[model samples]
Target: MLPKGFFHRRVVLTAGLVLGLTGSAFGAAAGNTATNKAPSSTSPVGSTNVTVADPTVPRPPGTPCTVQLFSGVAFNDFNPRPYAYAPPAGCGTRWSKVVLEADFSVTAGRQFDRTATLWLGGVNLYFGTTEEPSSTVAPSWHVERDLTDYSALLRQAGNGQALIGNVVNSTYTGVIYGSARLLFYPASILAPAAHAPDAVVPLGSDPVGNTVSLATPSSQLSKSLSLPTNVERAYLDVFVQSQNADEFWYTCVPDQYAAEVQECGGGNFREAEISIDGQPAGVAPVYPWIYSGGIDPYLWRPTTGVQTLNFMPYRVDLTPFAGVLSNGAAHQVAVNVAGANNYFSATASLLLYLDPHAKTVTGQIERNTLVGQPPTPTIGDTLTTDSSGNITGAITTQLSRHFIIAGYANTSHGRVDSTVDQTVGFGDIQTFTINATTYRQVTDQQTSSDGVSQSTVGGFVTGKYSEHMRYPLHLDVNQVTAADGSFTLATVAHQGDEKNLAHQLFGITLYSAKLSNTVDSDDTLAFDASGNLTSHSNQQSTQTFAFNDSLGGCYRTDVGSFSGAVSSYATGTGCPGQQNRLFWFTHPDGSPENGNAVLGW
Candidate 1:
């Protein structure tokens, strides 16, 4: 299951993927952070920044359907047990946006350290502390993960099967509980021109499974899939995870781009670089996964965890490359682990949206043309460390660099052009400890800017975009445990007033008018050695825009406000809505898990 939106990543290359990219990687990048910064020479800024839509596309009508396409099964063992989901009743082909959702919960007092996963077709949806989220103590918990990108597999065409399993925990007191489903939002809500891939081709291995660890260098894997004919749009959807690789990437790479106050050493900030037949395609950022930390809760999880649970995958809109790849030939699509480490692991798929009328599609790879890339990043000198290998030191990345990638897809539909600019102008400094109870202080000031432009056969059927984010991040996470086994996971994450302003020019109206949303969240989660919990959190987000319902859009200039105050360790329903959704974003930029998407990658 692959995902996509216009302005193409919102500009992401995240934990190692490209932009919820306008969302985190540089998978997706961090979008909500820099909401108010000035646009760059390559960035799209302001309301007057009109978006042109395809004239021939149908005007959306009626309320979209939110269907439950699948119901997942539960698992408690790592025996590769399987779960299943069937689409909502009345499901049909008219669907446009589809998202996979999973709800999994585990109570405290369990000694489990394994991941829970659901696999459909080639797409994988992970639960628990798997993939990358640290599997530490928390309350009996339930979480909903989004998998809209893989809507292709949630089809009524057949019954979908998902495999569920977790690494065994000897203390085993709590059962691993969960289910999976898909939420479908009809195409009628979007312009008839809304795009959905006609074919989703799995390009790599792991249909069975593969481990991304030291056994595999850089966690690199490659495969080639045949392309469909008349392809007008395409996307490279990727999933990857690594345990114990978090600190290496987060602290080592410094910033995906060179920083100002400090400079990064070590070539660790390597992204998931892809190539088509040896030609460079795109880059996916390597995330400093929460699972990459030490022996904790997530050790048993898959890829640390999936994005819906804060873990994520990288996606590259192959649409720009659509023109050059529509030959319906067997093409070479490869994922590169340029990070030079075996901790990063990955699996990839290429999704294509067809244009039946398109007689041909072709394009070229031009790296550093629009969105420049950072040079090889280096890690700073290792600092003094404790007996447990917890290094107590500071990092100063002294390089300021920029990465640009630009190209166009030529097809019967005209040119699908794109230019992305990801700049790392400041320093990304971090201090961390890898003991049982971890600690980190990160002060990062950087910018990730992105834009995409397109036109159809008539040229009037056009698309334009601009999104520039200057996110300056300052956060600290201290998950400390006392000798008595009492522990607290305190996190204070702050995003300066910044805006990732993105406008998709489609026809005369603008939809999803999310703009300049300032963000800041603080929380302190505490638990007994047995994992009972009380969490106190305060979060604020303001998404301001001027469009409204009358415009047949949802981006009315407004704000979303929410807060929480809790100090007691309550179970089940006691904590209400105390969970911190720190990575939430809006508009062109989709969150790591869900959003309104115009282009389905």
Candidate 2:
């Protein structure tokens, strides 16, 4: 009922763990370094407050090399676009990081934002929202991650692959240009005792074949794995997709607790737990992807906000259970992914790190923090419509959503507990009658996740984050001929803002960033009796800003706006600024930020 990139942009139903970080050496070693802090009063309510934690292992030793896997091009309106990237053969085992950079060719200071996944081994590893080392956004920006934690999956003989753009149906029609690359470190350096995955086993996709069709939600999935012996630790890597993708609303930033899931039946949720052979093992947050909509894989690319096939990946440390599976026998391992009602479906694999000479895993299940499973936290919601059945005209309206989830991870050192939360989002469209033949509509949306707690471990790690996706829009229809055909949308204007914020305390280098975006545009449209777009007219201006460098924030070079074919419009010089602003709050002494003056399209 609305234009592409409008309502569809917010219907991202994918679930994920929102882990935002970047820095040359601000991280601890690969081994879970023993970890945390509590929340301050200024902290967002219901925020994740980790008391402590252990850092994961370090990157494997290898001759560092980078290879371009895929490149992006400009997209036209409502076109079906699908893209993939296959890394150079034989280099999969040497994996270190996956880097993605993107921007709009003609749009001014477009906040180059999108979500993608890296397919490695038999699992789909999520790249979530890619932010630079410091958290920033602009035309042509990039984000990267060290893949050592998942080296068991990406460092396989098959190398790695990736999927870009909306696969369900490429309705995200923007002239987006982007690239994906993988940085490889040699495989020769992995320590036989403590480094690299010794074995990997897939238990299969959820619903058996990724086709979810069951009257009742089934939460338990188990598979038997034949062992090679001497296994020391393990990781339960899993990927999940809710039939109701709107659950993506759970990860709204700036504050998920302050946001709203505007639709009545929308899915706004958090956290999915995984158990190994009926024993509690790992837990990860269910996050959101705002720019993902218009994707309906089940309906064969149906044009609607209802999403059927969208997935996010997360992992749980199963090392604590390593002792039980190292007896050189076939053991039954299972991960029961739970959510609201029976609305949970997922696939999991046990990546085993082994010691070829050691007797067996000695780690014991010393303690379990959470007991007796509970329901997920929800964002309060309210939806309203006017007499015309549209979210506009004669009837004024207001909507909001803010909710939270809280828990803790306990270790021998100190007690660790945390609270996680989110603000789904708030937006509305308005209409007024100038006459029976004239009407005007305006839209205003504001999304902020000032408080969102993904996870926290005592003395180990936990943090808070925020993201803002807000915009205001206006449209006027001065003429019409038939049933929603041959209509003239006189003018369309919008003001947009996007930003990401992450605060972390992981024992090593404490990291944080304030990344933000700014965008403004004006456009016009006309349709013929045949419902063909007869007008190629538009005028837009844009600008993106950043107060931190770690988030990949920068400014775009004005390409000047134009009025003609969408392709003929101007482009920019990508996000400009020190792309390498050192972390640890290390910007040039009192560095001056590029002002809003450099913004117009």
Candidate 3:
């Protein structure tokens, strides 16, 4: 099990160490650092809060050349900070490995968590939310991502922007600052350059990179592109961030009970839909990510929710449509959220792998059974109201879908046929009891996806990929008021994320892995009769992360905290033999593993 504050403290110390060792060299290399202005005299104190995630990105055995993207950029308003980017100098354009690293800090004071995004050439590189600050606690953290697949876009010079929409006033007084850089490892005899997408196409309303806002199901974010004709494989990475009334969608109710239950409408099912020239291509499940300030802020003081600091985009296999896309005509690729309520922010990018030996490839979509729209959810409710205006009842919602897409392309090697079979499911159940002096709500929700992609040449399988993912969440809230108007609020939450993946090339197992992370927390807040804040207690939280792959890479850690400080920390508890285990036996060619797949469709 993971402790609430252990991960946060560990990340803080690690970030400080990195800064201490390379601050001077990085500053000297960055000739023109972006900056709004120097911070005020009352600089924010570095925070100890951190997100629960893998602290390291497996690397090759070689030195890396660093390139500074931006440094110490301040964000206090709605404007975006623009920066210029160029390829690294010493490292050649083709690198064996590329990584993106960033550091962020917020001033100590009262402030709500804000959203942050980085975009280059109209493609989103990063999307996440900042940590909330308190009068005594200021938070700082570091994040890293493997950008080796996006090499095609990073090979050229471009202009990008970093947007951290924030509000700083007499009430909300916290300001956010950020610095980011890229590391490129040169290819050598031991570490050869890996295969990467030949072209990357951004899908959004603007060409210079920006997130599109979708207020309803009818709204769409689409892009038209004339892609290369030799495309052999294709995939799209998609992101959908819930905002406003949609933030707590899991606890929502049917439209008929919106007023009675006091919850959001449109049911509790949401998904991202992909389309190729108005034809259904694939589906991506929406993960429920809670921000630092969500619900009761005290619950996340030291530890944050899963992917709260840095989000992982869902990859949708579009290889079946590669034949249709390679026709050399301008095709419209679009993304939209199903069952959207109020609004949502969305972004996506198209990745294509070209047939190096073939100048032009031709084929057509043989079969596509996926419907353009998702099925309507089924909702059930049973409630009874008494004479005293007290209400008690339960509500449930469920939705599921299954589809298969198949196509063939005549490439330089041979006539390659590809098929994608997938299934998605979602369910939410909520129980409520409300009265004049008491209010209670409990929610249990789950979202899952299972899929298999296979490629064949002349009826013989060439590659096969399989992935299974599940997200489970539970939340309970109880509030009681005394006759004198004094009140107490108690909350408990349990969240988990699990994924298993495997890749096989010509019947040879190249990669396989399993990952699981979970967090459990509970707290209580007391208020005076006059409604002024009084005290909080019983604040406790714990987290655990376990990961293992066929490549001999294994990591496991558990930690717990109480009253906002770490209580215990342990490692290797979930590994073989119960011995602390953390190591990486990566392939010399930089093959994908764990979070990434070698045969990504």
TM-score attained by model 1: 0.61
Model 2 per-residue lDDT at 215: 16
lDDT, each prediction: 0.41, 0.34, 0.73
Count of clashing residue pairs in every prediction: 126, 71, 11
Write down the lDDT that model 2 would get: 0.34
Q: Determine which window of 10 residues in candidate 1 has minimal summed lDDT.
A: 49-58
Which one wins on lDDT? 3
Per-residue lDDT of candidate 1, residues 239-306 (tens digit): 65543333334444434322321223343344566777666566554443333122122111111111
For model 2, residues 411-500, the per-residue Cα lDDT tens digits are: 232233434344443333333333333334333333333333433443444433333333332323233334554444444333233334
TM-score of 2: 0.44
Each model's TM-score, in the order given?
Answer: 0.61, 0.44, 0.88
Question: Residue 27 in model 2: shift from native, Å?
Answer: 40
lDDT (Cα, tens digit) per residue for candidate 3, span 72-116: 998899898998888988688787778778888889886667778
Candidate 1: residue 434 lDDT (0-100): 44
